[model samples]
Target: MKNGAFGRDLLVKALYGSFKKLNPLDLWHNPVMFSVELGAIVLTVEFVLEALGYKKGVLWFTGWTTFWLWLTVLLSNFAESLSEIRGKARAESLKSYKTAVMAKKLREPLPDSPYDTVSSTDLRKGDLVLVEEGDIIPGDGEIVEGAALVNEAAVTGESAPVIREAGSDRNAVIGGTKVVAGRIVVKITANPGETFLDKMIGMIETAKRRKTPNERALEVLLVSLTAIFLVVVLNFRVLSEYLVRTTGRGEPASITILMALFVCLAPTTIAALLPAIGIAGMDRLFRRNVVALSGRAIEAAGDVNVLLLDKTGTITLGNRMASEFIPVGNHTFEECVHTAMIASIADETPEGKSIMELAKKTLGVRSDALPKNVKVIPFTPETKMSGVEVDGHSYRKGAFSAVKEYILRIGGTLPPELERVVGRIAMSGATPLVVVKDKEVVGVVALKDVLKEGIKARLAKLRNMGIKSIMITGDNPLTASAIAKEAGVDDFVAEAKPEDKLNLVRDLQKQGYIVAMTGDGTNDAPALAQADVAVAMNAGTQAAREAANLIDLDSDPSKLLDIVEVGKSMLITRGALTTFSIANDIAKYFVIVPSAVSPIFPHLDKLNILRLEDPYVAVLSAVIFNALIIPALTPLALKGAFYRAVAPDKLFVYNLLIYGVGGVIAPFVAIKLIYHLIEFFVG
Candidate 1:
C-alpha cells in the first residue's frame, strides 16, 4: 500500500542491480534460476545463428523465445533486488537517530561525584555517567545509583515513561532515551559502535546474512526438482527419435524447443520469490518493533510449542500497587491507612509511592516531608522490612512474617485475626504487607499484582494453536496458584529461583519441545540462552538482551504472540507458494508438451485443450506467461500470505484447496487467454 521506499532514486538503483544479478557468478548460487539462465543463453545463441542466415526461416520464433527467456531471468532478479532495497532504506532511517550528544562522565559512582562533559561517542564500557532530569542517556548501561522515570519513545515507540532504578531487574537503560524525571548514575555496558542499536543496524544492512535452515532445506528441494526435470527433458530427445522411426509421422524435436519446455515446467515461480519471502519476514518483524538477530531465530519461532513466560511484567503488571488498607484487631480504617502511609514515607519503591498516593486519595493525608528527628530504614532482601523512626516511635510495613518477628523482638504480640487476614490476601493472589506502630500491629496493606488486560484471551488463542503456556514466579504456592488460574495458563512453577527457570527450559528441550522464553532480567539470561526461541525486552539487562535471539523494543512480555504469528505467516506463505508453483506445471505441460511434439505425433492434438492455431505462437505465449507471473506475484512475496490462528491440520487443508487447486485452474485460463491475444495482434 505504501511505496515510499520505491522513490525515483531507489527504483533506478534497483533496476541496475537486477541486471547486475544476471551475471553467471551471482546466478550460480540458485540452481533453479541458474538452469533457467543457461537455457536463456542457449536460446540467445540460436537466435544469433538465425539472424546470421544460418536458420533463415525461423528467425522470428528464435528471436521472440530468446527475448522472453531473458525477460524471465531479469524479472526474478528484480523481485529480489527490490526487497533488499526496501530493507536498506529502513536501516538508513533507523541510523539517523544515532546522533552524537554530550554526556556528563562521573569521576566516581557516588551521587555527588564531580563529572566532566564529553561526547557520547567517546564514552567506553565501564564508564559511569550521571544523568539528571531531562538529560539524555549517553549509552546502553545499567543504573548504578538512584532511580528515575525514563522516556524511551525514541527506541521503543512507547510514549509512557517507565521507572529505572538501581539494584532492580528494570535498571537497564538504552542510549538516546531521556530521563524524564529524577536522577540516576549509569555504568555504561557497551563501548563506542558496540551498542544494541549498532548491532541491530548491522544486522539489517549486512549483505552476508546467513540463510535459515528452512530456506536452505527448501533450496535443496528446489534443486532436486530442477535436476529431475532436466533429465526428463533431455530424454525427450530420444523419445522424439523413437516416435519418428516407428511411426514415420513427425520430425525430431530441436534443442531450442526442448529448452523452452524445461524452463516452463521447472518450479521457477517459487524459486524466484524465495529470497524475497525470507527478507520480507524479517522486515515485517521490524515493522512490529522487534529485531531478530538471525533469520534462523524467526523461523524457530514458528515451530515453538511451549512458552515459558515470567509472571511479573509478562503475565501481570510488574508493579504491585496498594489497593486497599484493611484494619485488623480493634484498629479503625482511618488509623490503619494513616500508619501505613507514615511507614512508607521514606520508601521510594513503586509499592511505597502507591501507598502514599492511596492514603492521600482516601483520607487527604500527605506524607511528602518527614518530621523532625526522623530516621529512614530501607527495605532489604535480608530484613524484608522498611520504616521510619520519628518522635521516639517506630512505624514499619513489610511481609507478615518479617514484621511479626520484628514486633516479637520488641516485646509485642500480634492480634489473633492477623494470620487469617494475611492468608486470605495471599490466597487471592495479593501480597499482604503488615503495618506496625511501636510494638502493636495496626493493620494490613493489600498490594494487588494486577493481571494484564486481554491476557487470558491471548493464552487461549495460543492453546488453540497447540502451544502450552507456563507462568514462572517466585511467589508462594497459594499466591502462584491463584494468579496462574486467573491468567488461564496450562501450568505454572511457584517459588521458582533463577536455576529453576533454567532447568525448566533445558528439560523441555530434552523432551523434544521447542520452548520460547520471555524475560527481562540478569537472572533470566541462562534460561534465555537455553531456550529454543528467546525474546528479551529492550528495557532488560544487557546480559539478558545478549542471550536472547530476538529483542522486543516495546518491552512487552506478551509480544511473543505477535512474533509467533509473524513466523507462522512466513512459513505458510512459503509452503503455499511452493505448492502453487509445482501445481502450475500441470497447465504448462498441457500447453507446451502437446504443441512441441505435435509435429512428430499429430494425434497429440487432442491434448491441446487451449486450441491454438500455431505451435510457435503457443510456445511463445507460454514463455510470456511464465515471465509475467513472477512480477505479478511480487507483492505477495514481499507482504507474505494472510494467516489465521487455527489447528495445523485445518490450515493445511485450506491452503491445499486455495493455492494447489487454484494454481492448476488459474494458469490454464491465463495461458489460453494469452494465446488468443497474441494471435489477434501478431497474426
Candidate 2:
C-alpha cells in the first residue's frame, strides 16, 4: 500500500511538471481566451490612467510572450500529429504480432483423433491415416499401406509428383498433397507444433528480430547526432542568456532568440530522412517479390556465403522412379521378380516404391492388396536399410554395405552373377539393393534418381559470382561423389548425417565464411538455425522455416542472389547519402561563418546597392544554394537510380567517385547560382 501510494504521488508530480512546461494559454483554441490578449488590453487601460512609459505597460511584454507561445503551440501540434502516426503504425504491428501468436498457440497441442480424420487440427504424431485418389494428405507422414503417386510440389518445391508406398525409408510425406493414383495409408509423425509449416513461420519471426550491421550502425549514428543537436541547442540557449545579462537593460530579447534557436536545431531533416529511406527500401523489396519482413533481414542478406543445401528437395529432384532394374542370382529371372515384388510391397523408400511399381507393370499383378502374415521393418537412417519377413525367415534388402555385412555375419557371399550386375549398376550411378531370402541371394534392384534441371548452370553462375558451391548428402559415398561431380560443385561432403551438416556449417563459420542453409525438412532445421543467414522454402516444414532467417516463397535459388544484390545496394546508398549530407554540412559551416563574422572581415564585407545586411545576404545565399543542390543529388539515395547490374567493387568505386565529386562541386555551383539570383533581385 505504501509503495502504491508513493508511485501515485510520483506520477502526479511528473504530470504537474509537464503541465508547467507547456503554457496553458496556448492550449486554448480561441485567440481571445489567451491571457496575453487580456494583459495587452489591461496595459492600454493602465497607460491611459497612469500615463506611464508605454514600454513599461503590459502590452509589450504580453504581445511578445504571446507571439512566441503561438509558435510553440504550432510546433507542439505538429509533434502531436507525428506521434499519432507513429502510434498507429505501432498499433498495427501489435495486431500482426497478436495474430501470429494466436496461430502459433493453435499449433502447439495436436489432436489424437481417429485415423479417418484428415483435418490437420485433428491429426497426431504417428497415426496411420488413409488417403485415396484426388484426396489431400492433411499431415506430414510416411506411406504405410498400398502404393500411390502424389503431387508434393506445395511442400517440397518439386515440380513433379513422387511415387510412395510402404517401406520407403526416410521419405518425407508433406501436408496438402494430392494422391494422383491408387489408395494409400500414411503414418502421421509430425503434428501441429512439430510440423514443417510451423517451423517455417517461426523462422520468419526470428528473421524479423535479427538486426543487420547497417541498421545497427545507423542507429548508433542517429543517437550520436541527436545528442550533438541537443548540445548545440543548449549552448545557443546559454549564449543568449549570457548576452542578455551583459546588456544593462533587462529586456526579453533572450527569450526570442531561444525560440529561434529551438526552431533551428530540431533536426527536422534527420527525423524525416531516416524512416523514409527505410520504408522505401522495404517497399521496394516487397515489390520485387522478396519476403524481407523487416529492414534488418534485408541488410543481413547482403553477406551470406556458404549455402548448405538439402540434397533431395533443394538440389536434385525429390521425386525418384525406377529407371532400370538389374537382376542376378542362380534363381530364374521370374522367381527373382516375384521375390523382389513381395519384399518391395512392404517397403517405403523412393527406391522401394519404384521397384514395386516396375514389379506391378512387369508381372501384371495388383499391389493394392497385401499378402497376409508378412512382417515389416521400416528403414531408418541409422539402420541404412529395411526389409520384410515370411514364414519365420527374414528377407532383407538395402544399401550394399548393409546387405554385405548381414550376408557376411550369416556366412554367405554375393553370387558371382549378382556381383557383376551390382558392379554394372554402380558404374552407371545407380544404387543396387540386394534382396535375400533365408540366406540365399534373390536378385538386385537397380534404382535411378533424376537430377534437377538447370542445376549445373546455377552452380556455374554461383562460381562466376565468386561463390563456392558445396554438396552434402546422407547417400553412400559412391552415389554422393558421383552426383557431386556431375553437378560440378566445388566440394563434396558424402555420407553426412544432419549433425554433420551442422558441424560443416560451424566449421565454415570458424574459417570466416558466412554460411546460409536452405532446407525443406526437419533434418535441415538445426543447421539452418546455426547458419549466418538461413533460407527455407515457403512450402518447407514449419520447423525448417522457423529455423531459417529468410523465406523463399517460390524456393528459387536465383531469387536469393537477387535479394543479396539489392540489400547490398541499399547499404551502399545509405553510406553515400550520409557522406553527401555531412560533407555539405561541413562546407556550409565554412561558407556561412565568414559571412556571419563579416564585421571582422570588413575587406570582404560589401553591402550591395540595396544596403541590406551583408551577413543576412550571405546566409540566404548559402541556404538557397543548399535547397536546390540537395534535391538534385537525391537520386543517389533513391532505389534503382544508379547502376542496376554493376560489379560490387566497381559499384563502390563509381559511387565514391560520383558522390565525392558531386558533394564537393554541387555546393559551389549552387552558391554561384544563388548569388546571381540575389544580384538580379537586388541590383
CA lDDT of each prediction against the hidden true structure: 0.88, 0.57
Off by over 4 Å in 1: 1-13, 99-154, 159-166, 171-191, 322-327, 330-349, 352-397, 406-413, 435-443
lDDT of 1 at 205: 80
Q: Candidate 2: global Cα-lDDT?
A: 0.57
Model 1: which ten-residue window has the lowest total lDDT?
A: 365-374
Models 1 onward score TM values of 0.88, 0.52
Clashes of each: 1, 24
Candidate 1 on 431-503: residue-level lDDT in tens? 9999999898999999998889898999998898889999999988888999999999999999999999999
Off by over 4 Å in 2: 1-213, 225-271, 280-296, 317-468, 482-488, 555-559, 586-590, 602-651, 670-683
RMSD from true fold, candidate 2: 13.4
lDDT of 2 at 589: 50
For 45-154, candidate 2 gives per-residue lDDT tens digits of 54454345443434433343334333333333333222223223323332332221111112222223233323456567866666678877766666656788878655
- Residue 363 in model 1: shift from native, Å? 7.6
